[model samples]
Target chain A: MSSDHSHLPSETELRAKALESLLVEKGLVKPEALDAIIETYQDKVGPRNGAHLVALAWTDAEFRQRLLADASAAAAEMGYFGRQGEHLKAVENTPEIHNLVVCTLCSCYPWTVLGLPPVWYKSAPYRSRAVSEPRSVLAEFGAELPEEVRIRVWDSTSEMRYLVVPMRPAGTEDWSVEQLQRLVTRNAMIGVEQALAPERLAP
Target chain B: MRGGHDLGGRQGFGPVNPEPESEEPIFHDEWERRVFALTMATGMLGQWNIDQSRHARERQHPVAYLEQSYYENWLAGTEKLLIETGLISEGELRSGAATEKCGKELRIPDAEAARKILTSGGPAAREIENPPRFAAGNEVIVKRRHTLRHTRAPDYAQGCRGLVREHHGAHIFPDANCDGEPVAHHLYSVEFPSRELWGGGAEPFDVLIDLWEPYLTLVDGNGE
Candidate 1:
């Protein structure tokens, strides 16, 4: 180590070193094992998994009821609930109003469903606008609620987590339950976008 | 920059903010490093070019190369870790057999896993726990608590009077001073006038908060 450690390592490097040193001190496991475990879990239990579950729940009423009532347990039934997702809750959207979730402090999200969060969820524009100017944020996602309709923005903290269950769209009367289910994207359930209609995907 | 999880009513970027804290070591080792090194090692070999490619559509500017370089340096460090840890063999890294898992399923897809996770405990069992001292329609006040840790109960709501409308289940307590156990706490649907929380010309009926039970004290008729 040079005396002119003035060119100190970047925050990223310092954090990584700190974590590595902590793990070494704890003797919990090797860095390699931790890396491999993270890789495996992140790969297996990322956001796409949650999207699929939302798609299924959208198509099933009984399951949706179970989910809204007990999100953590319901998520576990699909293998999406674990250490990170133990404190999950799903706030549903309705035709009358919409719900959009944001992490005002840090990006504390239900990683089990929505993988590594998109850069925007952790951005200043989102954290600020989602609370003060929520209507505009919703507009960015093409979800414009009526002026009279209330917009509830759930700010997730460390303990309580939130998920938005979007409303079912119209014009899918003839579509099979399975076909209608495909229209539910991760953004839709997050209240950013309304569920896509069957025609929206038509050629 | 606030912590990655602390952005409330702030603005910048398009819903994306990098935590000022150092990158999570695990992520640095895996993706950031892998992508950067692969780009650079190939650049040095003369088989790949950097300047001309820097002006690609995604870059939208020539300066992106600098950003990429910074990212590349971080990536190389993680790759070195991978090699040291035997996560990938030297031959594999050289032969392009060192596959980096991106957008790949780990075991089961997250979407599929979500279904099971959400449905695991039946509906009856998932409700928020009842606070030892309160119930629905009970008049209570938000307790004033502060510390240096992740806290779910907001400070503004402290000392505010409201009715306990619902009971959300027990969760991992974020108050750093607590025992770290998953304690039982009720989630209340506390109603405050927009005037009450905002303190100026707030809507008389515009009141809302899904507060935890611990953030409250019973309010007497005097509005204390």
Candidate 2:
């Protein structure tokens, strides 16, 4: 019964508040459950989960073989299989090919491993231009591949979500999983950029 | 439907300027989180599937679809689903009050229960005894037909020729799922050269899209 409407929230906020209140009042939705759902995505699930798998693949050759062979089963090993990530297909970025993922129809992303998608991933520009001008798109993200390397753009038009396994950086052979994980950014898994270079992580 | 959401290869969008991964916030604002949670929680009621929820948002006008923020689109879709499914009346939404009880029994999950369900994740992949229509490496053409309803087939890929990269097994047909009918069909990752989709001058790249069987046909040598 907090009736402090003095702040004058926006229409969107007011509507959201009203909808939440109505659902709670009708006993159709639990506020605690709603908080739990938000907290789960916000805190628990994220690109770090994908990063962990990436780091493992970089370090362990057997795990990398399993991951490339069957991504969903491999992800299940790390307990990262659910929701949008039910049918994940990892596309490895070798020296000859670069992979990029985009959901042109909508922002259909692998929420289980990568959490919620970024604003740019869901934006119209990325969706429209990713397939048509992938080289330019990659360049925009500061990832410039040479002309000889072929680019493969995965358009997520169905239930399948693509996870780009970025090429392991050079001079990181001795780095621990913890240190390697720190170098992995969310964009790297999405193929917008490569993993943080060893020199870049000096700070 | 050739809605604004079908944005692949078509131009005019400026650039893909992404925020640094470290600085990005999970929810841009409090309302976005609430709308997202509301969509998930209400979605758990089993009134509709994920495709139906997407169709609700797709049903919006092209301009409105482009203009609204991501969560705003979610709210719009949630509002539409609430009314369409008889979970809430339009009057209740406008007045910010529940006028009558929902006719159907709605079970609300507690925090722990919700977490378990979410973590478990309902997968749409179905097992079918029938053999797939097309195999990997087969060149196929996307069927060129527009239905005025929910369909996962992107307009950009329609009527375009592509090679089937792999058969992804049977999956819930989104068109049928959106229409409240659960049907399974063979899904394949079809790879079309960038030139085939956007013509010459485009980079030498292959755009791979997962297309269901119904939306594709065998490409005869005569180019029919």
Candidate 3:
């Protein structure tokens, strides 16, 4: 090990390294294995999967009905069942109502589809306020809902995960599933924001 | 115990500084990846179950639990579990050096196995012979519980009146599963109107929570 006396490894960094090395020496885990796990979450699983589901639903009314009726089976049909995704409930966004998802207890997200939750979704501000002052919180995300639109906040306190099937932007009816998927942002799925408008998507 | 991990309605936090989707990386730094991967790999050992893993993270002191960054908390819990389970010693965890050669009794998931297990991912819902006590549209009240231990029910949803939106079948009850045994119980998606939870003049909205059967009692009336 080379000397870096000028800046000792931070306690947090040191602790992480210590744990990894300890596991390896004990023959309990391989470093390569850890790398693989990280890679799986980093690239393999993410919002893209959820995007695919949303796009499919937009193009197919039957699939949309199935998604809202039984999100778990619908995801399974698309081969999207896994950790944090075993149980899923797709809440659709209509013109008259808005839906948002939050986990006040912890960041319990649909990993198989949405991948790992974003930093803000797991942060204290979003968690504490989402259930109470949701309009204010949504405003922060640039999602302003009218007073007439009812707000339904889903607080994930159990194994059940939620995905907001954001409304397809007005001009997206003729668009392809891939085109619609391009507008499905992670925030839209979490209910913090809505699906990107047609104009927002680069032409 | 009633730890600080529950952030339902307590106030005074600042802006939710969300990063731009294009700019935000999954793991902020190299160390985050290490901690995340370490937690996943160690968890696959099967020496501990998912509920126990959650309790480990939520069991931290209130101050530490609330203040620590997400990954920092994961490291704290991982360290605690390693020591408590006899997989890694306290001194060894601090020094990054192995002393006693334990953990032989544990199962190690290799790279391929790790991938498979995570993809297959453990599902908590288990089939139970007992029928669900409540059904959709049934009025129910969440009983207040002050147990100072691991609980899946949030403090905000407790002591409030709600209606059953859906029954999620039987799932492992966290309070009982803290010891790594699968105990399935009926879980329901209870929807509490904002007024019922926080009083009048509040945002006219509804909050839905997935609660186990034990935490709820059937309300005979339309609701007080």
Best by lDDT: 2
lDDT of 3 by residue, A1-203 (tens): 11112243488887787778778988989877898899989989999999999999999999999999999899999888877898889999999889999999888999999999888888888888999989999999899898899999999888999999999888877899888899999999999899999889777
| Candidate 1 lDDT | 0.50
Q: What is the TM-score of chain A in candidate 1?
A: 0.78
What's the C-alpha lDDT at position B163 in model 2? 99
Q: Model 2, range A1-203, lDDT digits (tens) per residue? A: 01122342499899999999998888889999999999999999998899999999999999999999888899999999777888888899999999999999889888877999998988888898898899999999999899899999999989888888998899998999888988888898888898899899857
DockQ of model 3, rounded to 2 decimals: 0.54
Ranking by DockQ: 2, 3, 1
Q: Name the TM-score of candidate 2.
A: 0.96
RMSD of each: 13.3, 3.8, 3.8
Give the per-residue lDDT of model 1 (tens digit) for B109-130. 1333333333342121133434
- lDDT accuracy of residue A101 in candidate 2: 93
lDDT by residue (tens digit), candidate 2, B7-73: 8877776776677777778887888899999999999888999999999999999888887777888
The CAPRI quality class of candidate 3 comes to: medium
The 10 consecutive residues of candidate 2 chain A with the worst lDDT sum are A1-10
lDDT of 3 by residue, B3-107 (tens): 888888878878787888878889877888899999989888877887788899988888888767888888898888888988888888767788898836666
Candidate 1 chain B minimal-lDDT segment of 10 residues? B48-57
TM-score of chain A by itself in each prediction: 0.78, 0.93, 0.93
Which 10-residue window of candidate 3 chain A scores lowest in summed lDDT?
A: A1-10
- Residue B106 of model 1 has an lDDT of 27
TM-score of chain A of 3: 0.93
